[model samples]
Target: MRYTSEDVGLLIKTTQYRHHRGLDASLAATGISLVQWSALREIERNPGASMHRLAELSFNSDQAFGTLTARLLRVGLIERFQGPGRVTHHRLTPRGTELLREGRKRVMKVLVLSFASLDEKERDMLGTLLAKLLT
Candidate 1:
């Protein structure tokens, strides 16, 4: 079997999907989907950011994020405020904060297992290479 850059790209995408699945399953005990937790994380990291900004940072479309925000708001996991020019901004509620903290622990465990095949040095190299590629 021959390996090419296209194969490498496909493998990268596949690995990411599997990693997301692992994280999602691990986080199920916390009662939040991966997407929801991701949204909460972005809101926590960028407090007072507009929904559009949050959606962009969370990698969702504006309309999809609008629906997500509505769900979050309804559940009291996040609160929205009117920013400048009537733009809606988001922040995590106490519940959201706790969930985020718990979710991070679960995610870390999944991430460690996901890369269990790699030694520390290989993991470091992979991280560096991926960062370089991303940048």
Candidate 2:
């Protein structure tokens, strides 16, 4: 079996698409999109994370972050509060935390099943390679 440039491109695109699709489907029951889910997860892990920080962490453009924040705000999942010197900070509501915890379990189950074919070493290598791609 040979891997071509097109194959690599497809691999990357499809992997991302499928991951997002799976998460979106699982999160649908929780009334969140994949991006919203991502935002919640990051905020949970990094309490008081700012919109700019979330944008950077998610690799989203300013417009994208703004859009997502609007949606998240509309859903009552997060709230913006004044931080030091009046800077804005994002905090997860109780509902957001519970949703994230439950959605994370579902997402993890999907990911574990998806990666079941890969050996532990392959999974580690994939993680390292993907990190390199990001960097």
Candidate 3:
């Protein structure tokens, strides 16, 4: 049967839910929410990144981004300092780095399980197709 718009919407929702769930499971013992984990990861990858930039990078709103950053700050996983344009910049602390290291290990385990069904060729094809769609 051909998929309808409803089918597509449901598929998207389901996929997103599963994605979050996997990340959540991975972060369970790491003391960070999925959003926080994502925020930290983004900041780590882009050193001296601002909250506005992080929001844009994560496709989250400014408010939502602030919430994530606040959580990380409370946990001492991130620090906010002054930067160009007087913007507040975020950087991971040593503890934050350690947490990220632990969190990534867990995330990788979850990812391996999630993609276990896909063989190497299929995985490559999926990655290529996803890149095309993203661009």
Candidate 4:
């Protein structure tokens, strides 16, 4: 049977779904969803990102991101402060940083196992192809 572009697309989507499920399972002990982890990582990297900016970065609506932030705040994982323009700036708390560190350890294990079948060159080629697709 000949494979078409649609076949490749479906495979890519299925791979993504599987990866997401694996990551969700890995993160279950931490009590955070993939979306929450992504927001935390973004805030950790950005230091003082605004809610609007983070919402944009996370591809979430303002209200949805707001709810996510509220959950983070309630869990003692992050703090929000007043910024210049009256926008709230988010920063990871010490607890948040620890959670991220531990979460990354778990995620790295899953990633390493997931890519174990790929040698270095194959990994590089796959990475390049994925980057090209993104661009």
Candidate 5:
């Protein structure tokens, strides 16, 4: 059977959905969604990053980032402080750091399991192709 471009797109979307579902399942025990984990990971990597920058990195709108950060704050996982030019700087709290460490391990386990069937060369090729697609 021949596949059209739409078929390829649908396959990609379905793969993404399945991957995210797996991630969600892995993270459910941690009480944080994948999006929240992504935000926390970004903050950990770029401490004192501005809310705007974090939003951009996370591909979230300002309003969405605001809500996400508020939830993080409520959970005592992160702290935000006003910085120069009224920008809000974000940093992971101690609790956040600890959670991130655990979460990273969990995520790595899931990733390893997901990619277990792909050998190193295939993984490299897939990464290259994905990068090309992004560009």
Candidate 6:
């Protein structure tokens, strides 16, 4: 194997950061940050999911997710209701659903542009390798 000064791990991290930044920038006009959109998407996926579960799915701490939920509530993007006992569940409001739908379009464009350098086979291979790493 050929040795190089740059670490592959760092390269992967930087690539991910650039991709996230690109997506976030593309979503600026949607009135929600990537983090908020991500939480909304998670809520849509797991309707009636508790805040803790949503936080985990969205890669946020409970407190952070609570703050996010509060903001979304203020903006009327999401609503919360008591489940059983102290547990609370969330759902996307109609506005939230609309924003999420629009955000998907913007994110898709950014992702496509980001991977434009990679051909179909290479993109498939890259996805497989990345999924393997996660596993």
Worst ten in a row by lDDT for model 1: 44-53
lDDT by residue for model 5 (1-135), tens: 897989978988987787788888888899898889989999888777777888888778989999999999999999888888867788889999888888888888988898899999999998898889999
Lowest summed-lDDT stretch of 10 residues in model 4? 44-53
Cα displacement (angstroms), candidate 5, residue 69, comes to 0.3
Candidate 4 Cα deviation (angstroms), residue 35 = 1.9
lDDT for 40 (candidate 6): 93
Each model's Cα RMSD? 1.5, 1.8, 2.0, 1.6, 1.8, 1.9
lDDT of 2 by residue, 2-56 (tens): 9998998899899888888887898898777778888888877777776788887
* Candidate 5 wrongly placed segments (more than 4 Å): 1-3
Candidate with the greatest TM-score versus the true structure: 1
Model 3, position 76: C-alpha lDDT score = 91
- Residues forming the 10-long window of minimal summed lDDT in candidate 5: 44-53
Q: Candidate 6, TM-score vs. the true structure?
A: 0.91
Ranking by TM-score: 1, 6, 4, 5, 3, 2
lDDT of 6 by residue, 5-106 (tens): 467677788898997898899889998999999999999999877778999999899999999999999999998888888888888899999999999999
lDDT, residue 132, candidate 2: 95
Task: Report the C-alpha displacement of residue 17, candidate 6, in angstroms.
Answer: 1.0
In the range 1-135, model 1's lDDT, one tens digit per residue, is: 897999989999999999889999999999999999999999989877777888999999999999998999999999878888877788889999999999999999999888999999999999999999989
For each candidate in turn, the TM-score is 0.93, 0.86, 0.87, 0.90, 0.89, 0.91
Model 5 error, position 24 (Å) = 1.0
lDDT string, candidate 4, 1-135, tens digits: 897999989989998888788988998898887788878888988867777888888778989999999999999999988888877788989999988888888888888898899999999999999999999
Q: Which whole-number lDDT from 0 to 100 does residue 55 have in model 5? A: 87
Q: What is the lDDT of candidate 2?
A: 0.84
Off by over 4 Å in 2: none
lDDT of 3 by residue, 28-82 (tens): 8988877777888899898877678889887799999998888788879999888
Tell me the lDDT of model 2 at 40. 83
- Report, for every candidate in turn, its global Cα lDDT versus the true structure: 0.92, 0.84, 0.85, 0.87, 0.88, 0.91
